[model samples]
Target: MGALQGRIAWVTGAGSGIGQAAAIALAREGATVVLTGRRKEPLQQTAATIKDDGGKAVVRPGDLMKASVVGRIATDIEKAFGRLDILVNNAGLNITERSWRQLKPEGIDLVIEGNLSSAFYCATAVLPMMRRQKGGVLIHTASMAGRVVSPLSGTAYTAAKHAVVAMSHSLNMEECVNGIRSCVVCPGEVATPILDKRPVPVSKEDRAKMVQSEDCGDLIRYVACLPPHVCINEVHITPTWNRGYVAALQQAHVGAGKK
Candidate 1:
């Protein structure tokens, strides 16, 4: 049997990219994965993939930006699974604007809600169940932007991600005694659909050079499989090629030419 056999894992943003890949990975390890996302069709697709691979998965579609919906999702999982072994807070988004001057108030709110507030709601909702069970893992899919600013990710996204990392640390500090572990994963320039939202569009070649969703999925699986006594508080992963630096240099050269 796989390491996570009989565990119940809930993955947010399971429709595509890292979230979908993580869901599949957890299921392969024998977890009964509950896939949550804003859209039902994509969530269904993820579930189908898991089933095809002889893994179990269920779709739970809802807008996580709403605290009420996040709460309902947690309650639903409890009713179905009796306990949740893992919660992957992977849902996130960014507006196309990178500069603060270009960022509208609405966009800022959207980014905060999508990337930070939703995670907060989900974590809180699952805390009670995890506490009662005496153990659970909470993994947040933060970004490298959380550690350092990047023009590509935009200010709002960076701010939200930074907060996510901080939030994870706080959760760990408060709940480690309760047998709850929180980890923040900060990946650099992953070739996910969210890349399309970058202010500077990533080229196909560049995307190929960047980290892939499956890489992250595998990492998360490893994290989840660790011994109960071990807790990885934070992880930062980046592509070997360092595309962000290369892109910045290229832009600088172009600006020099224009000058």
Candidate 2:
């Protein structure tokens, strides 16, 4: 149970959803977890719940879109724990208030800034320290939407997620030599507040197809628990219902090309 008895973990978006679940799971495995998000109450609540269960946790609420806060988060970790063993870049925001057409500038900024850039900032913040230590595990939450556009999510959300996938691949190639294990986790759907962050609520039928937050949370821990040499490059979680529509599209395109 204490596979990670001495590892230090930093989990963004821990106030809820996969981040929350991942934070608690890390603690369950014996890591001191730092929970970060925009709101303090939720972070505190998550920390409290973990502490109540005999897990060590801390909270650092900040706006990830701001580089300053991102730096602060890194500093906070350094101040509190000195070195980090695991990093879960699970914080993401989907701005569904307006369509891409309506939000050509503002919406683009919000989506890229919140989802993609935030992950970039956090990863960059930790890389130097991890490289110096000679080993660390970093997990970034992408999405099935990146695998293919979803009817339920916006274009910007999908683009930013795809960026995460690309970023992770690039980081894997860049940092593997330093004993850093990087992974991109693509989940189909989860019953998290992220759905509510949309302009409208997702239907019950769609929610049923979602992988639970706890499932993804445990998946994060599984990635974290892997042996130093065993690197899980990318883990994609999808409901059995997710037939490869993108594959079908490719097949159709080839058929058309022949015609």
Candidate 3:
């Protein structure tokens, strides 16, 4: 039997990228995965893949930014499964006009709502059930931007991601007493569809060197498989050939030539 044979896992943003990969990984471990995303078709596709692999999945698409929608989804999950064992709060977004110079009020609102508020809503929705069960796991897919300020990710995206990290740690502080664990995953330069939203295009070679969605998925599965008494507060993963480090090196070389 799989370690999570009787577990119920809810994966947000399961349409594609890390979320899709995470859902599949969890299901393979014998968990019944409930997939949620903004688009119904992608969620359906994810469910289909899981079903084809002899795993189980349910597709429930909705706008997670809305608290009412999140509440209803949580309520439905409780009715269908009685308890929620794991929550992958992985939904997030970044826009091309992310810098302060180009950022509009609307852009800030959109980024914050999608990256931070949506996660907040989902986490809040599932806490009650997790508390009742006396044990659960919440995994937030934050970014390296959450830990460091970078021009590549822009102001709004960085701010929202940082908030996500804070949110996860805060959850652990209060929820660990109830056997609930929160893990914030901070990954650097992942090659996902979100990369298309970058102000400057990332080279194919760079994308290849970056972390893949499946890598993050496997990480999430590892966290979920840990004993209930064990809690991994935070994890920071990055590609071996980190782009930020390379860029700094190249810049230093050019400055040395001019000196």
Predicted model with the maximum TM-score = 3
How high is the CA lDDT of each candidate model? 0.93, 0.88, 0.96
Per-residue lDDT tens digits for candidate 3, residues 55-161, read: 99999899999999999999999999999999999999989997678889999999999999999999999999999989999999999999999788999999999
Once superposed on the true structure, which residue ranges of model 2 sit more than 4 Å away at CA? 241-259
Off by over 4 Å in 1: 247-259
Which window of ten consecutive residues has the lowest lDDT sum in model 3?
94-103
**Global local distance difference test of model 2:** 0.88
Assess every candidate by TM-score: 0.95, 0.90, 0.98
What RMSD value applies to candidate 3?
0.9
Tell me which residue pairs clash in candidate 1.
Answer: none
Per-residue lDDT tens digits for candidate 2, residues 1-259, read 6999989999999999999999999899999998899999999999999999999998889998898899988987887777989999999988765565656787788888989999999999998889989999999999987777764578888889888999998988999999998999999868888888777777888777668899999999999999999999888887665535555788999999999
Q: How accurate is candidate 3 locally (lDDT)?
A: 0.96
Comparing candidate 1 with candidate 3, which one achieves the higher TM-score?
Answer: 3
